[model samples]
Target chain A: MSDAEERKRAYRLAPCPAYDIEGTESWLEDMAEKGLVLSGDGFFAGVACFWKTEPRQLRYRLEAAPEGTGLWSGNGGLPAEEAVEINEAYGWKYVANRGQFHIYCTDDPSAREMHTDPDIQALALNIANKRARANMITALIYFMIFPLIHLRGGVLLTAVHMGSGLMLGGLLLVLIALGRTVARVLHLRRLRKRLSAGEAPHRKNWRRRALYHRRSRPIFIGLTIIWLGFFFQGWSNENLGGNIMPLEEFTGQIPFATLADMVPAGERAGVILFNPWIFQG
Target chain B: MPRKALSGLTESMFYVLMALCRQPMCGIEVADFVDTKTQGEVRIGPATLYTILGKFEREKYIEVIEVSGRRRTYSITAAGLGAYAREIRRLQRCLDDAASEESQLGRESRE
Candidate 1:
């Protein structure tokens, strides 16, 4: 075979290591700052400049062998053909000479053709918008519904003895609204980044991910209000009996002949019974 | 078989399939054939080409035939041929419509 053909064959046989471009660039830059030399043109083809001499031998080894043959098993090395294929798919041109391979990329009409397709652009946009909306709705539900359920179950109540459930519920709503607004702003920022980069918006769980973060806000606010109510009501005090001994003695002496007698006669019944000592004094 | 017609395939897919249709080739050969045929108009990146090839393999449109030392060779399957035929018919309709439109525009311009 001619020298060119021989080189081409060797290049085709070499294993190409794929690297994420941004990752590789950052890593190389850091290494360069540390006086390390890394060399290669394309994303996957670049090897650390320090390891330039034995590129093949220096390739990182896989912990476990791949399913296929033992050939090209260890190391980040990829077969030349595979490397060329990856480069081509990424709109790169491969030039093989002797034992060396170089990858080149230029503005090609095909790249423009693919990018300018109206259908593809529309599809990408649609996917991103859907993801953003899904996140927003999820955040809203999470912050609102969970607290309401807890309040209904009597597991959470605002203010000891105040019994103003409505006021507490309103405060919960305000907290949730504020939380949702903050979440929306953050989500919009992320969505903008994805759109600008021409990347699809990622949704962890279209249904749950957005809602999960917001749902906790109401629960947290409800818990806080309930705790504050208890704190002010002196529930945490160990000496409630000592603080109102006379009132407690009078209530304890009252005998309920029927279930009806045990029921409060009016809205003022609790206050009248619980604070009788102050009236007597 | 004379290369199955490439009608419905994406331009890159069609060329890759066509390249492998003749003989089992590794990823590089298919990419090179595409570049050669398109006269450097369509360049397939190595990553994109392999990803598509992996999809083709998963869909049973292509299969690995052999591993000659370090070089792996892939051949098109029956389904691949069917896909190529479908793609060709799709392209034919598209071409015919384009031709008719061009002719109508030409006549209009002349008049």
Candidate 2:
């Protein structure tokens, strides 16, 4: 093997937990024995082959590149359009093409391999968990904090009066939970897809997800209760006060009520007050 | 010092502390260096990477260095270096013990 090939092998062997070279190689060997020709650029592209099975699987040979060659391109190597076209021709999904290197995945064989890889699935789950956590935190901050700070009345009042803060906070928390649930559901759906298609078991961060859910559930529920109590009180006060008090009565105690009353009395009230003789006649 | 406490750290956080031992690196550069060194063994997703970096910054393990323009860089503090050294020693001791066990096992098998 050449230097590039050696590096590629090393990369392949570097405990991805995503792709299983041994299993993939065995599958490839079986296919080759049954008359599939496996060929590709060892350094840039790892493996490639065409299968003659019932469904007809297309495979791309892959090898890890150290300086980051074709398997995962960086910038300035192959034209993106050309790389995409090539990937399509070989039935590969274009992942990314940067710095002349191109990465692609195949729905047929590549998907199968990926489905069987524990590491890749774990990575995906990790990504999803991270996203869910971030969104949850953001929702907590925005819904819980923003309204508490800058509402018309005040944080506590808004929580009690308008219930806007609580409502908004509840909405945010629910949305975040929903988002996390959606992510988990999607992850499960992917797992199901792989399983139905006869793929191996993949690693999942169920423990972490469970822990996160456990930690967040109480906090979310507590916040909801607190905010809801405040919001309802505010809304009730606003409602009762609105129904009971007329605008005139409501404004009477206002500091600027006299100023408003003086505006519509025709001639300048201020002038008349300053010079009583002018209006006395 | 505590396994439970360390367990709370994400893998990137652990790597970030390791990276900081050499020198402080800005978020982007630290991420890039990790990717390069690991040769893609660890691919830090953008959001996770930034969030962890922010936490570290908040904790004072790393401090912002340059904020000239849109780009901000960070470097490890003295405290961060000390923490990194401690972690390295811990790992080294574990490796040494493991190696010794393997050697003893080999001798026993030969006998």
Candidate 3:
């Protein structure tokens, strides 16, 4: 692959959690001079994409974020257009948004940093946390609903016996995501407190090292392949089911004397018959 | 957190207000002026200046006098002047209190 194409390929699978916005901003700046300008990121889709651009160092910063307005409505608290206008006046051009966080970049050699005061930065982070927690709550509900309804209504004994790797994988995803979300929320609250108390935010030491974009692509591709397999399996089972009770086999000449006589009567023995979607005569 | 008013302005805030009091200036100009005024001791980052400018304008401490493309020239309002004066008084009080306390210590030591 060409250098730009290789960077583009690497860009699609990288994810930086919301709690590490500053770290991700620094990472983006580092990536930008290498010709991969951060064009977009999907907090909901869990990926970040970059655009091939000329090689020039640019500073990246996260700005006014929506409380919890999903990816499409990154409108956060301040309207994006207005935010852009205001920020542009300050020399920071709006790049794109991730979740509710608005990203900006500037190439001005003398451009002032977008975030100067630690206290304001801390407050912005706290606001972002509130939105993140809201999103997490929704995601948590979805995780619970999926297992409770589709995964045999939370019957662990039955689910375990079924032995579906997909089920186990989904559950693991939910657990890991939940743990990470909860941890982030707690950390944000603490950091917010320290910032409010006038102490400089000292969180870099505890931050998770940014996952290399190039390294994560294969893992992401593997997950996508597994998901497609599950989807096809479901589609096949629905449309190409094995059991079929042909209508041609049961002729109108066959008459039942009575409903009770047709079916064997002895405590109404229930025969579990297979049902199929498409029947062929 | 509640917005900090005139009583508790930081060094950067004080210098920014001081810079605006002299003349209308854009963010870049203000930063440069402050750097010159403080002799490189107090350096205001561009990002920090951008934030402070927005805030000062919002609080009516400063008013935009002119906008030329991305550059905006801001002049201190009456309120900003008052804030600067109050901050100066606060520092003066601290110095006066320190000087008196030192004199008392000297007398006590002599006795």
Candidate 4:
């Protein structure tokens, strides 16, 4: 195979900085200028696949897909067929979509901007704002419920008993996810407010923002994988009785002593009180 | 989908309904009608137009008359006509009230 044919597909961390619509569109256009065109298949596993092609300018626009279009319910990341037809007629080709953000591309410079009215665009973004708010609530509920669910030994105690590195990593992951969700919600709200005030969507400079995300994504992914590893290890240990030992076998400093330590072994001979086995880290 | 109560039409919504009242029109045709009728004062984006279309359809304010290659032509329903008529009356009343107030002020100034 020829060099270009051999290297047909290239994958990059999707340069969507928390649904910054203009930034993402600019970043995708920038990618096309670098001969890395976004593939029609779209992003998978947070990585966008691009075709290695000759450098060219492509205008990428991100349109917000409102709820109940069934696009979110596993319609293969494509917008409604009717929506696609309408966009295509206006010279914009429907590309891949990520969640509610549908990406469109056009080489035509005069593709009559996807959305002509800011007020309408704001209405579309309301869906995203609602979704973000829902996510923030969910994250908040998880943040509250998680500690209570793990309250038997407490999250920190469990960390110490199970795997400190793993538990800490998991905690960090959850905190980051929650923070991201809240940030997205706030950003969407602000954008909607601006749009409703009749302000057009601004084209933000994507270079610096894209650079920061590209640098940070790999580290974030690595940490996530490590956290996942620890999570599964802990899960297996719990179910398979791995690292479980009787209290007497535990050599670590015991905060509380059992009945055997408090009373004479002969005095407690026939009666069994509490199970003395502890799951050790 | 459960129908939402109409709480007064926005300028765009009112224009869209007005455009549909003339005859059945597709999305692009409706957009064009609104643009031309307002002499470009009011412009409806594609997303907004579709959103309004979807909403109107849900509220029984419009019905699809033709579906040719994703270009669905819609006509205003009886409910939609009623809404448009109500809005027109509402606007007329506002104009009448303003005219009356201005004439009363003129008479008071003359006195």
Candidate 5:
């Protein structure tokens, strides 16, 4: 590639492994070693931007911010100015933050660890743990509310109104979100317990997990899209009673057995009409 | 949820209070003081140091004396002094109890 092309190609984007702190740190370090340095931006949107350059070793650390402070929407928040300055003094440069985690990196090989004390690091993680617990509660409430209010007549009746495909897709999505929330809560709890016991977080091979997520996400999203397509198709089709038409003007076979089907050929049969969209009180 | 009150001092917390006994200090200065006081035995990470500082300030145990840019200098409050003194007395009692127990055990062994 030409120089300009190479410069243009220098910028690259990758999916971030959310809530996997050690994995993320190792992933970023690996990227740095491969000459793709994190560009200190876009981590909040569950993606990281990197710039291609000469390969070098770098150490990345994540600091968990206390809940309800900077992350109102889980995007674009830096740690406190004082905290950043103190760490900066110790050779750790403040980088972009994703959710509650403030990312920092240093090129100094001898720079002191961002958290030298495991007990203190565990104390720091308590903030993230609180947020995870809150998220789990919220997800649980959502999971409960969906069935209580909407599925009054049972799943089949609700499914009839909102097409079975849409209903199933919606339920699956809610379940997936709830499952993720539960998993995060459990993971944070386990990690906090380990930290409380004075154990530090250990690095893992992030490539395998990252690649798995990258492959699975598309399949999950594609299935959701297909189900939504089914819903819209069913919603617009006249045969499903989505559209209204006069019985005399209707030439197609009636969906259900009507009064006309039981009457003799010469006798007249009364047609009772009701709106399919409206519920009769 | 009910917030847990800071009742007793951990080793890090005690050392931090000890560091502030002399004069007001910033975050890095406080860490250095604790390190030197403990002869490098106790090293406070940046996060731990700040968290303690923030919590202490919140509970009126410490107060910010000066703020310049990103550096905050903190001085121990009267409440902070009381807490530190209480912690010291508690440690003294613990040591005295251990000494007494050890002496009694030594006598029994000799007997």
Candidate 6:
């Protein structure tokens, strides 16, 4: 197989992040049931690697790292070595991790549920919320700053140079990233409120929401494909001076005055006289 | 659980503290004891058990007496016993108050 094909074989991106952890876990479980087991996960929010295997019943758990729990930075950093050691001790094999939540899976049906107490689950989610809020602040900073850099001069002029398609593609990506981040933060806040009220977190769980829904996965995958296509198309059309050269514009400076100037009525459109750059009849 | 577990001990927490007061047991054993004592009525989630154990340790209510393989044995401290006894007394008082009210109501009915 070619190198590109091999690389494609290795990685398949998921539709969401650990913030939509419930959906991701459920999705992973479904994948596992289908004999595609998630073996590793990368840093990118939507990236997950899988291994083909015999179908088996598997249970996946996502736990928000409690405050002062994770070994390293705490406050929702990572699951520490000790934490992994302890979880392994408890028969939970570590599967993957993203942001504040650590993922684990066990095939034992009677291995016991990850969370028995809703109150403690709520507290763990609270710790995760602080981290989620922090991420949103960081996103807010970038969201505000990114547009300023792009909109430095003016929108119309930028659009003309960058190609409206290109700009729109970028804007689409930014809006999506912002939307997902904001939605996750809001979901956490709602969960936290329910938890603090001594209500169960699973009542109207965030897993089945639109953001984490199975149907939304296709939309995200489609968007990524479109974004990549548009971005590459724009990238290839770029000029040396950093100005965009759209596919329509030819090397000649003069715009097509009339269809007869270049069509069968005038001359053959293929040949170009390249002697010191001059158009000849 | 609640921020102030002292205010009202959750049934699981209360049992955990109660079991530990009697013997130094590992996590699974504690869970088993609770299940058996309640005649399989109350079930503790592993996550909840770990969280409660961690909190109890943090508060010095329970101290780790031994670690054998993956199992860490914990026994209740003086504070844990005190808390458990206090909760029991509170529950007893409430029950006693209900009985007294019932007797008074019975006397009124007789009249």
> Highest DockQ among the candidates is held by which one?
5
Order the candidate numbers by TM-score, best to worst: 5, 4, 6, 3, 1, 2
User: Rounded to one decimal, what is candidate 4's iRMSD?
Assistant: 2.2
B42-70 in candidate 2: lDDT tens per residue? 75543335445555666677888876443
Give the number of the best model, judged by TM-score.
5
Residue lDDT tens for model 4, B1-111: 663586778788999999999999988899889879999788776666777787788789999998897779899999999999999999999999999999999999999
Model-by-model lDDT, in order? 0.47, 0.49, 0.64, 0.76, 0.74, 0.68
DockQ of each: 0.16, 0.05, 0.20, 0.44, 0.66, 0.26
lDDT of 5 by residue, A1-281 (tens): 47874573344334344677787888889888999887765353355767777899999888887533354553335677888888887889987775557788899998877876666677677767677568667755655444434543666775776666677777786677667667776777787787778777757777666666766656666776786576556545534666667779999887998766866576554322343333464
Extract clashing residue pairs from model 5.
Answer: none
Residue by residue across B1-111, what tens digits does model 3's lDDT show?
A: 785553467677888999988888877778778879889777775445655666677779999888775556789999999989999999999999999999999999999
Candidate 3 residues A1-281, lDDT tens each?
Answer: 48866655445444355555556676677677787777644333556777777777887776646334453543443333434555676678876766556677889878665655565556467657877777778866764445435544454742463346755765665666677778778867776677567765322421254455334535654675675476456545545753335757766654647555655565342441332322331
Residue A179 local lDDT, model 4: 80
Question: Which model is ahead, 3 or 6, in terms of TM-score?
Answer: 6
lDDT assessment of candidate 1: 0.47
lDDT of 1 by residue, B1-111 (tens): 463332245566777788888888888788778879889888664444655576577667899998765456899999998887777888899999999999999999999
Candidate 6, superposed: residue stretches over 4 Å from native: A1-11, A67-91, A134-182, A192-281, B1-7, B63-75, B97-111
What is the lDDT ranking, best to worst? 4, 5, 6, 3, 2, 1
Model 6: per-residue Cα lDDT over B1-111, one tens digit each: 545544567777888998897789988788788889999788776666777887788778999888765568899999988889998998899999999999999999999
Chain A alone, model 1, TM-score?
0.24
Worst window of 10 by summed lDDT in candidate 6 chain A: A201-210
Which model is ahead, 1 or 4, in terms of DockQ?
A: 4
TM-score of each: 0.37, 0.34, 0.54, 0.76, 0.76, 0.59
Best by lDDT: 4
lDDT of 6 by residue, A1-281 (tens): 57764444334555555676566677778778888777755335356777677887888887886553333565345554444555554567877676677778889877766676667776667767776677666764565334434543665665676578767766776677668777877877777676567764322233445455446656766887776675545445553334546647756665647645645564544533443344443
- For lDDT, candidate 3 versus 4, the one ahead is 4
lDDT of 1 by residue, A1-281 (tens): 58763332211111111111122223333333444333332222222223222222111101101111112433333334554444445454432121111223223444311222222322333333444345456755664445434433432442333245644654566566557556544544554465456563211222333244335544555676764565344433323543355544675545547544655676455675678775789
